[model samples]
Target chain A: MSFALQLFDLVGIFVFALSGGVLAVRQRLDLFGVLVLACATAVTGGIVRDVLIGAIPPASLADWRYLATAMFAGVVTFFRHGSIERMRNPVLMFDAAGLALYAVLGTGKALAFGLSPFAATLLGIITGIGGGIARDLLVARTPVVLQQTELYAVAALAGGGIVAIAHALGWPQAPAMAVGALLCFGLRFGAIRRGWRLPVARGTDSDS
Target chain B: MSFALQLFDLVGIFVFALSGGVLAVRQRLDLFGVLVLACATAVTGGIVRDVLIGAIPPASLADWRYLATAMFAGVVTFFRHGSIERMRNPVLMFDAAGLALYAVLGTGKALAFGLSPFAATLLGIITGIGGGIARDLLVARTPVVLQQTELYAVAALAGGGIVAIAHALGWPQAPAMAVGALLCFGLRFGAIRRGWRLPVARGTDSDS
Candidate 1:
């Protein structure tokens, strides 16, 4: 990744960690618990992506910057949670930004690892959602991604698919990534503001 | 791993998948949902272990047999759920057995990848509980391992610690693994049957 992209990755990790830390504070978990959730939420998605691509000791584990950034976010959130709680649904924008970056970046990495384009795209989607799922599960909240609310998965797929398609066509990385990220963020932002949602299964009482 | 260990791995996957399948049926999830949960439960731990150790395309993804076994378990559970439900807390035994196998195997694999014994032990514990956690979270159950009512994490730690210690002492792998698995299963069984519990943080009304 370019220096610009690497910087964006840290930013994404920071915001995602903030969400985890805020949740821990709301749950009244101790300092250690806050830090644990923060770090786990920030790193899990990338860790899963790296692991699948055979990258040992994932950047989250091997590179101190990733964890350091998470801890910093955690400590800050711990002290400033009152301000955060006062904000209106603060984590949503952070999540959309992180999702967009992760989707594109994860797709790029998987392609670099020689995965098939389809597999890489799927991995990208997983990368986008994995951390959020972990954070929600840890805090005992039902996963919002699985809840058929907003166009979360659709936005990620759009971002990841753009990267994969660009790669197959030998397009320049920076431009492709920029457009992909913008599209993902736009889609997610629109979905949130305009109420785009997938139609869930009907007939609540029906089952196999 | 040796042939016997590999066979046990399959058995572990089967039993764990059975738990997921049973849960899905009880929850009245559709057939696709049932298979998804079953496969997710069966393969998540090994996938995490392999990813941490730089194993590409983790066996759960690379090999067909692991998924085949899980699917088989899911299909059987779907059909025989009446019989399974008739049994007494059957999934508890299956979970303990799977936990024991995963802990030892995960530890051994981590060591083989040259991680420090402490790190390997921790990884082993994560591997033991990872699948169960995923299964519960997907179905909106509080993670059983995180609940203070059970000795799940402790049993996994003991089993993983034994494997790490045995390796550090240059003990034979086969015997060490057998003993480790037995110890883990025994501890978990006793904990569940005897209602052993961990101390929970008091004063639920308190906040930071």
Candidate 2:
């Protein structure tokens, strides 16, 4: 079980790191900036969750595997950015897959740590989106999560809520997590394919 | 000692929150956004420090006083922004005060947590600047800390380093902390007054 969890975490980290590295490349940041963003995006959310839950030193810092995965992703993205840019759809799919896994795993971890269901759900969404937010911030841009029309945060909330509910209902862990991940991935994929967007606020009278 | 620490924390939170609120008003964010940015700016640094050191739930979340301070600052800023804007120098002074206090407090806490001197110093700087970075990010701006001309991070590092060094030298905790704070405040205050700036990186041939 631990090995499987580790594998899942590594894959998620790799994909997230790649996204960060690609962004850094686009921004024309130095090599150091690219690696820093990759590592931060890959692990910062988990680190934030661990800290909030009182997990000291965070698994990302304590365990070298996570760092290694981020570095590997950054290197690959740096060298093959041209080809990777051409494969935008595949990259987006990978990002969605990572988001789904992170949401489920984050909720599960928060639940294990005795967080309230509401808090756990929030943490799960944070885990899914926190790294991306951090990445965008470093590059001086608004986070995509905050933008209207993206189903990112909404999908994370849904997936996290499902995990929390399943745990509350005494559902088996593995299958429950799987279902949560699938739901998150499906929603995100559909949003991308259909260009779905949430409604924006109409201009208030004060604006005019 | 605990009471004094709490008082210091509250003051810092108030000042930071005020800065955030003022920024929000300038950005034309609604009331909710103002409050969110205020609270985020005031508490994020300490939260980041607590998490890094394995302090659970974060003092900001655990203590209602911190939240109240943030809200109070936000409300005041929202209603009296014109006057607050006129008091720009005072606000900058308050921000410097907050930065000094946070740097000293953060280093002290990290040292208490048994972190190495280098790590503790870094944490102190993070505690000083983290909230501001968070504030800028939420508003979709480049962090002032990363700006080439800003001496903000440099001042933080110096103050934090003093605290760590004093601790390493077996100085009395209270006096050592006081000295660290004073140094940070003086440096920051001087920088603002004199328009001191760090050197920017020279443009490379690749740029041309």
Candidate 3:
């Protein structure tokens, strides 16, 4: 991965870990539990992606930096959890950013694995949302991905599509990545700011 | 794949789903979130095991029964959540049983895939704990597997090892599976009852 891409991934992991830590604190988990949650959120998606694509030893296990980053973030959050609690919108904002970054990075990695563009895009969305889904399941909540909230998957698709198109047109990898990331970030932030959401089915009269 | 084994798998899934549903209620999750968590906890480990062993489509999506079982449990919990809350210890005991069942099943499936016994045993542990790990991460808590609790992994290892040994001895598959499952449950139950625990290392003075 390019240095900038790597940087983005690191930052994304940190942000996601922070979100996990904050949520753990909110749930009154002990320190160990909080740290585990942070690490799981930060690394689980990449681990799943690598495993699916047959990357032996999986980057999450091989890369010490990712673990260290998550560990540091978890510790910081554990010690100063109250500040995170005070930020009412922190989880939403951080999770959105992490999703955008991860979606782009995952798509880019899929392309690197020589997958079809559509498959790459789909994998991107999966990678972006998979960890959170895993985390939510552990915490016994519905994952945001399945909720009728803003079009999170749509935003991931848009980002992945942008990267795929750029790559098809022979754009440099860096530019392609940037375009993907910007698209994801912009769409997610816009959705959050404007409260954009997909329509939900109305219950029938007979529905309880 | 034996009828008896399949029956146990279905029972394990059902009990596990019930535990997951109880957790959802305890967490005060909404209906959708509760169902998602229940299904995920009930099936994600098997899904991961199948995917890792290159079992096409994975069991979660291939067999409708697993999804139906989990969803039904979720709905039941929604309607009779009060009953679940009143039976906390039973719910936990069932969850522990499911963990052992999944672990053995996963190890057996991996072995059937022609993986080495060692790998199969490892896969069994993963399958056993993976769903709960995923569940915890989603809810932003530490995974129960990594906690300082009873000898969870030790139970999986014992069960998986017994299966491998039975295979080596050319024992009948049905008996072998039963042995494996029984070993796991027995050891786990023993640990719970006797308060068996692994030793933890304190931080070094240099670090302090």
Candidate 4:
């Protein structure tokens, strides 16, 4: 990976780890639980993607930097949660940045792994949302991605789809990735600002 | 994998799928949710172990049999849930069978992957409990494995540890696996029968 890509990924991991740690505190998880959630949320997406694409020992496990970054985020959140919680907008901004970057990065990685465009796109979405899903699961909550309360998965899919299309068209990787990330960020940021939600499934009982 | 191992794994997957489907039904999830949970619970453990051990495309993904078995179990539960729910003993029996089989099977697979005995043992325990954890998470409940209500992880660890030790000692695979399975089954069954529980962590707030 290029230095730019590595830096982007590290930033994403740190932000995601912070989000996970914050959630852990809200859930009243112990210190161990906080760290576990933080690390799981920060790296599980990439791990799942890498595993599916036949990359063994996942980057998260092979490289100590990722683990250290996650742990650092966890410890920081543990002590400074009160102050952090008050800066909700900045936190949400960081989360959006991470989400956007992960969507494109995951798609790019899957392509590099020689997956079909469709499969690569799917993997990219998984890489974007997988961490949050794992974190919510650990805390015993329905995953936010599955909920009809936001455009999270839609944004991810959009980013991943863009990357896949670009790859298929033999477009330059750097520009393609940048455009995809921007699109994802724009959609997610708009949804957060406007409180947008996807239409939920109607009640089966009422239909019956 | 030998025919015997294949058969054992199929049985475990079927049983675990049934448990997942049943849980989804109880949670009032739709048919899609039921199938999703069934597949997730049946395959996640093996997938995790394979990924960690550098076995890509996971056995669960590479082999169609695993998917077929899980889907069949889910469909059966969807149709026969009323009758199935009435037979509590059978459900518990199946779960125990799965738990026992997965523990040893996972350990053996890890050893085959050339992982260290300790890592293999950990993977085995993960394989035993990972499915149920995914099932509970999907339904928005705390994982039963992590709770203090039973000797679940302990039983798995015992079985896995036994297999690791036997392998390290150059014991024949068949006898070693049989012994591990029996030990796991016995411990899990005994815990269920006697209502045995691990001690809960005392509340910290009171101490503070």
Q: What is the C-alpha RMSD of each candidate to the true structure, in Å?
A: 6.9, 6.8, 9.0, 6.9
Q: Candidate 2, residues B140-190: lDDT per residue as tens digits?
A: 878888896568988888889999998888888888888888888888888
TM-score of chain A of each: 0.93, 0.95, 0.90, 0.95
Interface RMSD of each: 5.0, 5.4, 8.4, 5.8
Q: Which candidate is the best by lDDT?
A: 4
Docking outcome class, model 2: incorrect
Task: Give model 4's TM-score versus the native structure.
Answer: 0.62
Model 4: which docking level applies?
incorrect
In model 3 chain B, where is the ten-residue run with the lowest total lDDT? B199-208
lDDT of 3 by residue, B114-186 (tens): 7666657767877887777666665776567655555776678788888877776777766776788888888
Which candidate do you rate higher for DockQ, 1 or 4?
Answer: 4
How would you encode candidate 4's per-residue C-alpha lDDT over A51-124 as one tens digit per residue?
A: 79888778899999998999999999999999989998988888899999999998888889877666677678
lDDT for A115 in candidate 2 is 72
lDDT for A30 (candidate 3): 50
RMSD of 1: 6.9
Q: Using alpha carbons, what is the TM-score of model 2? A: 0.61
What's each prediction's TM-score?
0.62, 0.61, 0.57, 0.62
Tens-place lDDT per residue, model 1, A38-129, is 87789888888887787777767656678789989988887777676666355778778999999999998899899988999988988888
Off by over 4 Å in 1: A1-39, A45-54, A62-133, A140-208, B1-3, B169-171, B205-208
